[model samples]
Target: MLYLSQVLGLVTLALWLYCVFDVITTPDTLCRNLPKIGWVLIVLLFPLIGSIAWLVAGRPERTQAVTRPSAFPEYDRPGRFAATSPDDDEEFLRRCRERAEEQRRNAPGKPQDES
Candidate 1:
């Protein structure tokens, strides 16, 4: 019974300390119900109940995390291989050849004979 009480006391102390630090570190805007300083005072004055109150009422509500788009979006998928080199891509080669042919046909040096 004595050991259990001691353990409980330690737990309560840890909770109190955690609440105090958490309140101190938390941003002023995020704190709810009361101001950040008020929450800190509550936790310091009333150990167990204050800590519980801080957790329940003063702590900021969790928002869904926003994932930023990656610069290399191609590699973001699971179970995927890296993209093939441009030289190995048939479509890329075909496009390059078509572009070259179009440029050749439109060459400025070529004389156009008008009918």
Candidate 2:
């Protein structure tokens, strides 16, 4: 009986410490029912009951896992923007290359090939 009581006491102390640390480290936004400080005080004052209360009522609810959409929409699908826009088209690239060649030829120090 004595050994059981001692074990119970140790368990209670461990729970109290865990609750205190959890309350301290948990973000203010995630804590529910009361403010972070209030939860801390509660855990400190009444170890077993307070820890249970924090676990049950004060802790944040777990968010649901994000699932993939059933119908894969065009815009939301993979590689939606892989198709080249007008600026990235082959004609646009040819025009840009021609302009660069013209500028290179017009530069004063560049010797033009007379072929």
Per-residue alpha-carbon lDDT of candidate 2 for residues 6-115, written as tens digits (9 for 90 to 100): 99999999989998998998888888999999999999999999999999999777773334566847877776666678775988889989999999989999788898
TM-score of each: 0.54, 0.54
Worst 10 residues of 2 by lDDT: 64-73
Say which candidate scores most in lDDT.
Answer: 1
Checking candidate 1 for backbone clashes, the offending pairs are none
How far residue 68's Cα lies from its native spot in candidate 2, in Å, is 22
lDDT of each: 0.88, 0.87
TM-score of 1: 0.54
lDDT string for model 1 (1-115, tens) is 5798899999999989999999998888889999998998999999999999999998988772334689988788898876789999999899999999888878899976566
Off by over 4 Å in 2: 64-115
Among these predicted structures, which one has the highest TM-score?
2
